[model samples]
Target: METLYRKYRPKRFSEIVGQKHVKTLFINSIKNNNVSHAYIFAGPRGTGKTTIARILSKSLNCENRKDAEPCNVCNSCISIDKGNFMDVLEIDAASNRGIDEIRKIRETVGYHTAQGKYKVYIIDEAHMLTREAFNALLKTLEEPPSNVVFILATTNPEKIPQTIISRCQVIDFKNIPLKDIVDRLEFVCQKEKFNATKDALIEIAKRANGGLRDALTILEQVAKSSKNNIDINDVRNTLGLVSEELIDNLLKNIKEGNIINILKIIDEVYYSGRDFETFLFQTIEKILLLIEENNNTEFINLLKPLSDILKDIKYSEEKIILVKLGFLNLINFKENNNKTTNKVLENIKKESEKIEENIESEKTEVMEKDIPKFDEVLEDLKINGDLSLYIGLSFAKIQEGSDKIKLIFPYSKKLHFELIKDKKSFLEQYIKRKFGITKEIEVILSNSTEDETLKKLSFLFGKNYKIEGD
Candidate 1:
């Protein structure tokens, strides 16, 4: 069966959605009988460049037409629609993009149409054609061939030579509007008898990102998987889309420096079968919005790590690792730059003599507890035959807290930290069994040693990151 994009493709000029500007120009050109012999249709993909080209081909040759529109009943329109018309030829310039192919067209430019007055040539992805081929085609486009009409469609018009561009009527096509895309999806739902909710169709349209063809393709995939019944959940499941709610919550957590919730959300997104790149891309766009409104430096810092994850995404099979690590980097950047939290910590630290005296008294007693030290955990990992985990965590500096074991790593030990963090459960289990400490295991990245600022950093951030004081 033909896909929805093919099956529901616009068969007439009036039926095409969006590109009112292109349609308006072409209508006046055709009505005036002054259509250019050579034309360029430049736009993004799925924006109906090729569709309009074919429709225009029909209008140029239709035996019976009404106001620059094809009648669709004539032998000309039927044969063109069925892809058997001799006068209408579509060339995929990506594959046949050389001088030899251009020479072939140059040879046949003057031949009489088999059954129509105009012989139309549509070159799709015309930008992929070699410079030599474009130069060769320029010769033909420059003169003669009164019965021939050439339409070149490309996503990249800037690559075409300026001399060639000067010889053609360039009709730039914009992306279809969101409302138009949704309305079309609704029409498809009605005609195809697909029981899709309005919100579901809107979700599909948004996912399509202003491409009507992409919207219909997504709708059909969800429709087929749903047997023509689609809802928001079906669209989410079919497209593996992270919900807007989750995406919003994630950015909120990043801004607030909520490490635990951020990790939890990453788990939710990963288990929902969402693609890592999609999830990261959505978050980056939202962060960009936040940075734009607030002009906040911390939010801007989050983008570098998020973008780094996008590049690193292809290097690993388990994407959850990169996502979790990237967000951890975000949390670190956020918390370390939190002026409000650090200010409170500074005031508290100023009067620390009393608290320090109190803490010093309890510190002795707390130290007597069976809390695990970082070295003992490493020793336990080694003894338990986890040599890789033992070796990976071996480089971390030890900081034993009253109720936790803190492991610190430098920037150079990032891979080691990631490896150890990935196996936190196993390491936690080993420490609990061997050391009798029910304490949580915390991992962090920092370049500072045990000092006053490090302690403030610990207070500002969550348990995932810890910095100690002497």
Candidate 2:
């Protein structure tokens, strides 16, 4: 059976979705009998760049086309739809990205169309063209033959040469919106005679991330996998995405500051063999909704770290642990922030007491660097919703100071130290919250350099290794 994406591909302009502007331009050009010789269609994949190009090709060549719409029954339209048209050439630039392939086009530029007035060349993945290949095509694009029209379609328009882009009219295609995708899925389900729930289609639409072709492909897969009525669970299972209930529970737990509940959800996600990246994204989407409703930055802050974790999920062995750590970091952030608020109030009381107490007495408490507080400060940082800072501070060592909290790191840890150091003011505020007294915050690289052998040993054995000579 043909794939739904190909089987139900948009053959006409009216069938395309979410890019009314591009369609408007094409319709107007067709009405005026004026079409550009060279054009570039740029946007995300499955947004119908090549599909629109084919429709244009069919309309321009259609013997009985009206108002830029092709008659499906006509020989020209049927041949073009089947990819056997003599005048319409579809080139995959990815495989044939060298100058030699483009040379074929340069050689054929002057020839009259075999079957139609306009010969359309639709080059997909145009961005993959080699720099030399683009150089070869530059002249052809700038001054193409009168009868030929070039439609360059690319997901990445930036890679295409400026000179090539300058000569061609550029039309950007947008990813079809979720509602449109859901509607399209419904249409597909009705035509295929498959039983589908609205929620199922919605889930597929959400999973597609604005790609209508992706949505149809998913729907087709789900329909094949489930012989019975297709529902949201089947869609969820097929996509390995968390359900709405789980997402709701996650946000509720996060808002209530229930770390245990949040961890439980994370554990459920892991045990269910769910895609952590997808789960993370779903969770973040819920968080964003909460932020929109409640205007909470706390949840908003988690997005950055979660996004970073998603980037690294493929590279890490323990992705579940990374996600757990991310949320734990958020929990720690909320806990430490609440602690900071209380400590600031306590610090005010302490300050007033210092005014009444002797200077030496104040020094005994305020000036004394509590070693345990350094761990607390780092813990607070780890939990404080700043994943980058948490990752950075993980590399530094806390040092003793009578009048200041000193953070020392080996030269190798300079990057981490710098990351934490960038948030010096926030660190000071955290210190004041934890210790009820603000101390000078100092970050410095170690003055003593370890021998190369010792450094290697330390790296291999971790920081627990004891140096006999040192």
In terms of TM-score, the best-performing candidate is 2
lDDT of 1 by residue, 266-333 (tens): 88877777788888887777777667888755556667888888988778897888778877876776
User: Model 1, residue 109: what's the lDDT?
Assistant: 85
Across 387-407, the per-residue lDDT of candidate 2 in tens digits comes to 786666655565657778677
Report clash pairs, candidate 2. Answer: 332-383, 333-383, 333-384
Candidate 1, after superposition: displacement of residue 78 in Å? 0.7
lDDT, model 2: 0.83
Off by over 4 Å in 1: 285-304, 314-318, 339-470
Residue-level error in angstroms, candidate 1, position 6: 1.7
In angstroms, the error of model 2 at 416 is: 52
